[model samples]
Target: MFNYPPIVCHHDFSKSDLSVDTLPKNVSFVRPHLQTAWGEFSLVEATVQAIKLLYESENPPDWFILLSGTDYPIKTAKQILTDLSLSQYDAHIHHQEIIYKVYQENVKMSVMWQMLAYRRYCSWNLFSLPFFKDFTIRWGHPLLSKPSPPFSQKLRCFAGSQWFSANHRTAKYIIKFHSQKNSLTSHYRRRMFADESYFQTILANAPHLNLKNDDYRYVDWSTKGAHPKTLVMEDLPSLLASPCHFARKFDIDVDSNILDQLDTMTLP
Candidate 1:
């Protein structure tokens, strides 16, 4: 293992099975955890909280990596650490400019379209009839102001995977920016799947952060669904061959064989 300290941020909504007392001295939890759910700003806030804490720690790491429980390392710890050491970019963040787009009825759309639709629009609870809800209809204020701070014609929106790696400098920048309540943060609070866009928007906009448009995480999305394909034993070959340091959406319950094999491969 890397042996780097971890600041576990528990979601307020879900109880953590981790025994706090048994955890190492370097491992701690973020105080006053908030309710977190998929596609919610709470997920963003949780990440921000952990970053802030880690950045302010007594012995802050030179690099920071954000990951979920479902994620697993494909490369060895030494390989990952060595990669970060020789990396030129401040952050490995998968990102792209998000365009404002509307859905076409009965038309198959890409995930980008789905991301734009849910991220740009807000749902209302105005309808209460049977099989009707306020959120059933998506409403948006696409005609943003000429000078919408943090986001406008000049400062466009960018989005990407929520998980990634960043150097200490970029990590510091994130905490400093997010610590203040800003228009960007406010707008993100209103949108859905804020986790995917919030950090990306900030990183993309920062002038000094040397960013690479690669998150170093492999996720198979070939199958049809809003979520990525759950990794299994069949994916072992691709996972090992990929340049990515990590691969995600693994389900040990579905097939622990994959993880078992990886464990053998990763043993020093």
Candidate 2:
């Protein structure tokens, strides 16, 4: 089993808020609140910072797993290690091209447009909008159209869920790729849901990385909602049987008992 160290990156955009005391020995809290606005660049920046921190640490991690606050482990530590040890892929990331033409025809007009051209420009989420009069922020200049050479030709644009697990080598490659490809990073920064495509595009384009195209995180997109449905008691059996190591969008407030059930199954 691995030691869990909570490296909290508190983003300060709207307000300054942070509180911590009596920390665990392994827990290393980043005290300063990074000046980050909501969107792709901010998310990318946070990830880069985490990677940098990891590299600088005395004990660098072998595997870099990105999980949101809402994410919960579906498999025990032993089980997760067993899967990783036996896996041959360099990285685990579920990805595909952004072309959603087939999906667009099946859905309603409103949903169709959103799914079809949602990544055309930035500001898909309200947090990036001009909600606050004085809150000035920027990700990148919006292009009149997709780049002339096509992003795919330049680096191969891929889209998928942001959560992923990559070995240290793959993680370093992503950061290195970002450093070298300034123009591509700048262009993606302005795109809606940049995090979803940025890393996927980078890793996918670099075929030598040997990405698995399976993020190993269970998410139910079948419910048809703005986000994945919150896992409830009814989802317990399926989740327990899943090969995925983690499951996302669980709300304990909705059903705290589900967490208890998961804890019994996941913990040693």
For model 1, the superposed segments whose C-alpha errors exceed 4 Å read 13-17, 101-150
How many pairs of residues collide in each model? 2, 0
| Residue 191 accuracy (lDDT) in model 2 | 61
Cα lDDT of candidate 2 equals: 0.70
Tens-place lDDT digits, model 2, residues 163-187: 9988878878877777785766877
lDDT of each: 0.78, 0.70
Candidate 1 clash pair list: 124-134, 126-134
TM-score against truth, every candidate: 0.84, 0.80
RMSD of 1: 4.0
Superposed by TM-score, candidate 1 places the C-alpha of residue 130 at a distance from the truth, in angstroms, of 16
TM-score result, candidate 2 = 0.80
